[model samples]
Target: MSQATPTSQSQNVQTVTIEREMNEYGALTVHVDGQNATRHIVEYASDELKTILRQLPSGSSVPLTIEPIGTRGNAWRATSLTQ
Candidate 1:
């Protein structure tokens, strides 16, 4: 058999700020400071989330990854920013 790609093991995630969001009652809410439309949270926060958002533009498309939290159920944490 052939060797597998070394980069295949890791997942690349993307995300956009779309304004600041908050976690309320176990739900991460997506809301804008001056907007009225709000969406329910899809995932919780992790070190990965912060790391990714830091790189992506405030409104650009990007990738985001979801990793296991070790038996506490899986969480979608941000990984890196992308075009």
Candidate 2:
């Protein structure tokens, strides 16, 4: 019998500045080094992240990491939200 080998893949994490909420759907518009990036604010977002967004006004700049999830990698999740 042949043993199956496991393959490792590295995920790319992107840091961007929060621009504003895209809509009521929990999506946030952000800028990655001045380029607009649309990131979805997952329902399971950390309390810290929600607090930060609540306190900050629209257009206020804040650092956050956006990453892809699931097998299709079509969806994104926000993380590491910081000032």
Candidate 3:
């Protein structure tokens, strides 16, 4: 398993959406603008993040601080999230 580390500084991403269901690996997937531009996934989401997601409705646009997870820069993770 790849250890998710913040490769770079936090990026201000807009129009972020967190999937309601977890993937096969039990990780929460996130998308920007309904597309897979920056494949951000939360393998272990914080309690705060979970609370935020549960309160918001589906397809709601939220602010997120995304960072590249691995050295490959192909995968990302949500370091911070806001409404």
Alpha carbon lDDT of each predicted model:
0.38, 0.55, 0.57
TM-scores for all candidates: the values are 0.30, 0.52, 0.53
> Model 1, range 10-76, lDDT digits (tens) per residue?
4434242344334333333333234464333344355565544444443543333433323333333
Off by over 4 Å in 3: 1-12, 19-26, 34-38, 54-57
Comparing candidate 2 with candidate 3, which one achieves the higher TM-score? 3
lDDT of 2 by residue, 1-83 (tens): 55333222323355555567545565665666555556555532486665566566666666665556554534655556644
lDDT of 3 by residue, 1-83 (tens): 76654434455456667554445454555567756564545533476665555566545567776666557645655557755
User: Model 3 shows how many backbone clashes?
Assistant: 0
Show where candidate 2 strays beyond 4 Å: 1-15, 34-36, 71-74
Clashing pairs in model 3, backbone N/Cα/C closer than 3 A? none
Q: Rank the candidates by lDDT, best first.
A: 3, 2, 1
User: What's the C-alpha lDDT at position 8 in model 2?
Assistant: 27
